[model samples]
Target: MANTSFLQLSPRAQRLLKTTQDFVEQECIPAEAIYFAQMAPIGSTDRWLVVPPIIEQLKAKAKELGLWNLFLPKIYPEGPGLTNLEYALLCEVLGRSFIAPEATNTAAPDTGNMEVLAKYGNQKQKDKWLKPLMEGKIRSAFCMTEPAVASSDATNIRTAISREGDSYVITGRKWWISGAGDPRCKIYLVMGKHHGSKEEPHRQQSVVLVPADTPGITVVRPLPVFGYDDAPHGHCEILFENVRVPAENMILGEGRGFEIIQGRLGPGRIHHCMRAIGMASRALDYHLNRATDPARKTFGKLLHQHGSAAHELALSRIELEQARLMVLKAADTIDLHGPKKAMVEIAMAKVVVPTMALKVMDRAIQAHGAAGVSNDIPLAYMYASMRTLRIADGPDEVHIRQIAQTELKRAAQVKDQLKHKEERERSLRSRL
Candidate 1:
């Protein structure tokens, strides 16, 4: 049985969380302007995929302070070995800033990829790609989502990976593959169908590690989210036209892609939910700051004094607190039990957090009126990113379906157990 009690962080986790909070507030948040300045000319040749100098400086500082690689639980010797719950708290703090995750080497795609490599990659694969990824020397992308199918259903993916003599030839077109547009992104964990119609649908897919520089691989374009390209870490459309990698590069061999995805996405979903909470909290902060401004008045009173505005703030607080608890509970479930056992909790959080975050950001944007949507504040971008979460990883409908089915099955089991208990009681009473 899962432990469904209050979770207490270890002394080490508490210290690390405190340290991370301090680092984000003091250093990461302050560096946003410089980061934006570097990313201002999104179409420029040099700036498009360039990591800002301030970010590197902040990364060096984060490394010096031992705040790097706090995401991986037990994979790397250099990692701090924090559990999912512990890392969720720190991830919330990092979510306040767009660049904070990469600064501390705890970013997504990389985090998921690192975990996959640590758990499944052979030593040679680890030495070639995972080592640099863990060290933050290079970035990586997960090529799973495709443009030709409804990717929410993994079985619908059409990318094909066929075995050749001493190598595997991968042929497909994938889009929304985050991090593929970056110059530093040197590797890709590509997911494709490995078996033909004869095989089981789930088992037919496989994941292979394709070097970004492999022949016939093309980065078609960087897809933008609500006009924001998220430069240096873009979601790209890529074409793998007969791209070939050594047969040894297949992760965990063929027919294990779905298994790897199950392991990878459980944590990834929780991490996204944790960060969404942080983003919503930051949006609330922005909203409160704007509303409480003494000079800003609406209907002959300060915005905060207005009844509707006040209610919005109150509602935001309540919703954010509830969403945070759900994320924490999901993280705890993943920590205590395996992902499979915690699937229901993860699905619940995955569905709730993003929706809640979008609501909070919408209110924040409304509160600020013009400045909210403008680049003057981060709310617009935050909203766009949060909006994407509703569809990314798995869509809301998919998670909702999963959670509902689990609940229905649980209800049926409860009914059966109650009936059995009643039967036993009746038999005992009759004997008495």
Candidate 2:
């Protein structure tokens, strides 16, 4: 339930939510094993080249069911006109299964890239890339994280977008670029230093829309999380050596990359949290199912009958509900106020939800004993992804620092107010 009983969802969003729930549970979850089974073997050249057949089948079904691209919030005319709050509900359902996100064309890197194009790209850029992306005919990657510097502080990025006459020559190294390994990935929304910019340090960077097929682009290797390769769609290390595009490809003019990312990441952080809650919910279901399995009794009683396991289940349930409420609140704030206003809430959710998911899933794995760590169940893989969430988008430490800075914004006023209150209390005591 995610404790979201009070959301006043629009009729269309409500309908989509139900449909998404059914699709993820009945189709995506069940088809997961078949989807994996159909993949090219790990060491094969086709491993990254061939997507499993089951995924396309699911996509076809999802499109028929009117469940595609639900992540785009209603503000963008390019989107399906659902609010951020509405999509949060549907996104949780998608989180229950690994294949559900892409099946519905609501996966990350793409969703975020779509938003970037819709928000910042020109008409030419939109027609060539956004149209194909929104239609799911092509995929894209966001190249921002670099290996040489601390990328968390985005100003430290050294990738160069050098202008040569009427074209921009881009040269850089980026790693952990999601979706870069996909055959359908045809564009890259790259962020790099706008060469020779005299603006402030924060404004020295810019984003550009580079066609993926352009010369001098090389995918060096795929990066794995824990042990999972996530092939077909991978996180990759790529080199851009003098990749050239028309200067018009620069997004929203130079010196605006920081502003663009802030706009992109706010909603994205919430989406990640929503999906994590869904994963935690599925893990809790595993906990309950395994805890009550009659054939798997422990010490002559069902596992849940044991005091320790019972407590763990209760704790997980509480944490799940709390995590859900926090995420939904952040979503509603974004819908009501906009992403900039919801920064504090988004930061809190980003910091909390992924960690909460790991805790809940870890407990579920423990309940399953040896089967949890093995390939017999999905918990281990799910945990690996959930663990990575803590560092993705923006890591917990980054968000935690943000939360603290935001909280302290009112510290001076609060200190004065508390001092006044103390003085009044003393005055009242003296009069008595």
Candidate 3:
């Protein structure tokens, strides 16, 4: 049976729910061998070349079923008319398999980048970029982090973007640039220092749209997670030296990069957390099944029936539930308040979900003995991905700081309100 917690879709969301569920079971599951083969430690160029056509075919089938573009806000015409709350459920469904998001054209970097353009880009800029992006004709990358700086503190980014005439020249080295290695990747939402005084650090940075084919842009290397380099769509290190683009490429004007991030990262962060939940859930299932298997058991008792293994499995379930509820609460906050207003909840979830997922993965890995960390199971890979997230997006400490400030301010506001009510009661009693 499929997972019941896959998503709770409304009547209108039923189509997307059914479509993605069917696609994962049929196409994505069947492609696991091909997927793993292509991702094998010793890579083959043929395996890499062969998988694209297979992915394209699966994507075409999904598009034909009207499952395309369900990841974006329904406020935009490109996606199914669903709110963030609605899409969070669907993202969980796609999270079941690593390949499912791409099959539906709802993968990361692109999803976040598309939202950035849709929310901030001008008509000409949207026409040149957003349209193709929404159509899934090409993929894109977000170039915000740098190799030399503590990218978690984005204010410290040193990538240089200087203005000259009608153009802006960019120069920097960025690592962990996800989706940049794909053959289909055609654009990059590059964030860097624009022509500005260094005194205003935040204002000094700007976001510009740079074509993947722009001159002087170099793919330095693809970084491996643990030991696997996710080919065709791996995280990459890119070098931009004297790369120039039309000044028209700047999105929502300069110094507003921070403003754009305000709108961009909220959804992206939650989406990653939701998917992490699904991945952990699946890993738990694998561990449970492996433990109980008659052939796999060492003693007469099934692995799941054993004291140590069962304890970890039980803890995994509890942790998974806790993380899910927290993510849902964060999603609700985003729905109730705007993303900016719900910043504390968003940051808390970004910190909490990944930590929970990492723990769940660790337990599952131990259950599998040494094989858990082996490429034979997805546990190792999922763990690596989740671990990076602790430092990626924003670090745990940064989010904790924001959450602390929010709680302090909220407590102070409540205290003041109560004091005012007491004062008003005292005045009324004296008048009486």
Candidate 4:
């Protein structure tokens, strides 16, 4: 779907991709304006309490159209059986419209949480949490990041999870907890350090399923990204004041937190990158539309007719195509090999895709002049969302470091080649 041959996709996935593209263009994009209008104004108490009715209407439509939970990979029996690469093709279409992701129930935190439960959760856990999640009956949050530490290295989280009798008590403060502010967000997949474990730092951590209604849990406020609240599914700052859950909620037993998260984040990161490509494509659309408008002229020439504007727009297109190839390669690699083996590709996509999207959106914004930065067009909001991807999951520096380390593995071999070159040069110099 990333401009690849149709032969690369199964017939079924191809059909789904076509269906999803049409659905987004016809239904999802049209409904976005209404969805925004239906929302309770920002800063209103009802912003969190009341969801847009249009979203439910769209969700019902999406379900009827067979577009629901398409994020679930083929490995899960409960899913429509799309592979990661296949879902990625469709995901870009969904990313074009903000409402599309939620309408189809493929939004973040939930997607990652559902993957975790499906892969690691016990029968009881699956039935209780994963079922409702899969059915779109509830939303969820992943509470791993902490305000007190550099959460990029997940092992640094200071949240305390201690076993006490029949339950485990969790105590810590977490920020940027996406989806925490949603009223429908009923469960939390919380990651914390197990108390008094002498195990290695990575092993001492674990994730537990916490019900949102559990005692001592407080949602302080939603944090904004570049001043956008992203209400209803806000990234929130929450305080867990001795919140407790059953010991049964511990996912895949103790000391396996890193393992579980590593699995969850790899695919999730790819999903985000794919969505970013979609956003970048949409921004380019806005850019072209504004630039080619005959009424909008600079020095008696249309904006696109100007060499500078044409060059910038052309460069944006080239950048998008180049970056998309990398992301598609990463997705295909994930399909062929597991995410663990595709870490280099995934890291490369994670680093490059967001950066690409930002540049593309900036060009689109410049084309629109002042209107682009305002809420007048979606470009500003789109820019903010893409910008966050640089830091979320893993920051650009972290992924760059991973890529560099992989390259550095060849340093010794390069050193030997350098020695050979030196000897060859000496012999040539002596002959001369």
Candidate 5:
């Protein structure tokens, strides 16, 4: 078992985490039905971009309980000042219900965006955007993936941000941009190449803050995941044609998009993994509930009485526990040594948690038979969301490659040290 002694959170974080657990159970979980009803398409208009009323109610309650913005770390003096390890525990609680994260103001794209602004944004930029985002008054989008290039290699981004006088013109087509479908989405963090710049591949990219209503900017459509267009926070495809923004909107200066990417994505990936553990735990609960029902029997035995079914439940519990421990460890590392030093651990958690969650959800769905595939349970949707994580942030293969490289480098260093030690002993032996 992984040691959890290092995860002793502060009293403030512990109190907030308990409050968050209660809020998610009492408020967010019960509001799922209302959220689903409001998300359904009505008449000729697509209501997918509308935020449900229940969400606002929950958000208000969350603010009153002081459970808002828990994802922000102590580095940002203006935030709740929770460490990454502490926030990870709170995030797992929020992940139990789909509505909880947004209610607590810890939803992605926004969390990542807030971190970027807090770390890199100038005072004016912070005043204009970060303040509203932190307040949960408005949402934002991250536009980096391009339709034309393999976005996994972020350096392949072809969007152009060219300088002209006091402004920069941005032209690109970005897809899979989460949170763009929200009507409250007011700003975008767009990544593009600095036109005519001769900087290295990694240094050539820059991220700029572009207002959603900027001239020539258009939201083309929302992309569906396994036929579910995640309403009000849909993943969208957008176009920017000669969209102009003041040069001052550039984050951390020109040719520094990769730097921001590294800083923003490290924490974002771990947050997703922590949430995955929560989702898996819920799925396991659903599975156990169904499996233990005496009314439902298979082969003249209750589901839980069957040896295979019981084993499956036991395996899921073990997997979920292991995944949770790995995520906590990763969060602790990021908290202690900074994100750069924690990359290997983050990559490991990112690869492990989603895959484990998906498997647990798959077994849970199987336990429910046909109802699992239907909207009667949240398993199908949860499965789809968890499945996406394997490709999001960075794909499993990418993380695997990174982990392998790190391990191989360490092995090489050990081998060199052993060789030097052996040679030194031989020299001493010859003298004897």
Candidate 6:
């Protein structure tokens, strides 16, 4: 049972939590090996086509059980009609099993991409793209990062979308375009500069919808993480050579890409942190069980009783729970005050959660002895993964800068208030 000493879910969320937890324990857990095994054939390729039949069966089962589209709000037609907080409980359960997310149509890149389209897309854009995405009939990729620039500084993005009569010519080389290699990935939402803008640095960029089959589009290769191909799904490097699309394909008008990213990323960022909390929790449990078990130890004493080992495990547990609370508090803030008011909390959680996950994973790995480095457990993968997250959605340095700036601003305000109070007190004394 979870330590409910800190926070409690509403009745609806409680029900959602139970349903998803049961689904993971029953369906997803049993099918993990099958899903991974199916991935073996496509190990060399990056297309996510191998599991459609299996996923269709799983999706059918999930939808029939009223478990479909648990990732979205009520505004989306297919969702279970839950708030971010409610959906977050379901997400945590799904996070426990990797297959559970896709099984319920809540997988990443797609989920984040769908969210952007849902908010900023015009009717034609929505009808053609958003509808298929929501239905899970097709997948999408978000093309923002590039190999040629410091992508962390989004304003440095050099991808060019130039106007040419009634069409736009897009030319750029993009890397880390996740889900681009999927056979079913029929669309890309590309972020690039709209060449006519002499606008604000943040406002010169625009998001355009590009069909996968568009002319002059080329997929160079897929990138691997820790030598794992991540096949059936991949992060691809692609070249857009004067790729032409109708000007109407632009989303939310020109210069609004940053705005869309701001809105889209708040939920996406928090969700990633939440899922990471689950991953760390799972790794800690696996490590603790392995180290403490009689068969895994020498000299007849449980490893949990070992001096430094026990302390590290205790620390990992505390860190994991602390990070989880931060994530939940961020979620609650977003739910209650909206993303605008919750920006500080969101940024802070992003910075804290992944770093905490990395620390917990490192301790878990050390406790595993040599087997930690091997694939025997998910610890090694989790560690590598958590480390990557420190850079994935903007590196830790950038986030720290934001956090510091926020703290300094608050401190300055406090200083000003104190000075004003002293002036008021002195004036009152003189009058008396």
Cα-based RMSD of the predictions, in order? Answer: 3.4, 1.2, 3.4, 2.0, 2.4, 2.6
Superposing every Cα of model 2 onto the true structure, what RMSD results?
1.2
What is the C-alpha local distance difference test score of each model? 0.88, 0.90, 0.82, 0.91, 0.91, 0.81
Residues 1-432, candidate 6, lDDT per residue (tens digit)?
345434566777776677777888888868867767666454444244564356667777887767777777656554667877667667776776667777887888888888887777778898899888877788899899999999999998999998889998899999988788788889999999976688989999988999999999999988888776566668899999999999999989889989988887788888888788777777788777877787766666789877878889889888887888888888878878887778888888899999998888888788778998997666787777678788887788887898898898889789999999999999999999
Write one digit per residue (lDDT tens) for candidate 4, span 98-157: 989999999998999999999999999999999999888899999999999999999898
The ten-residue window of minimal lDDT in model 3 covers 44-53
lDDT score for residue 391 of model 6: 88
lDDT sort, best first = 4, 5, 2, 1, 3, 6
Model 3 clash count equals: 0
Give candidate 1 regions above 4 Å deviation: 1-7, 75-78, 195-197, 417-432
Top of the candidates by lDDT = 4
Give model 6 RMSD, 1 decimal.
2.6
**Which one wins on TM-score?**
2
Lowest-scoring 10 consecutive residues by lDDT in candidate 1? Answer: 1-10
Q: Cα miss at 404, model 6 (Å)?
A: 1.7
Candidate 5, backbone clash total? 0
Model 4 score (lDDT): 0.91
Error of 1 at 49 (Å): 3.5
Screening candidate 5 with a backbone cut-off below 3 angstroms (N, C-alpha, C), the clashing residue pairs are: none
Give the poorly placed runs of model 5, Cα more than 4 Å off: 1-6, 42-44, 417-432
TM match of model 5 to true structure: 0.95
What global local distance difference test value does model 5 have? 0.91
Clashing pairs in 6: none
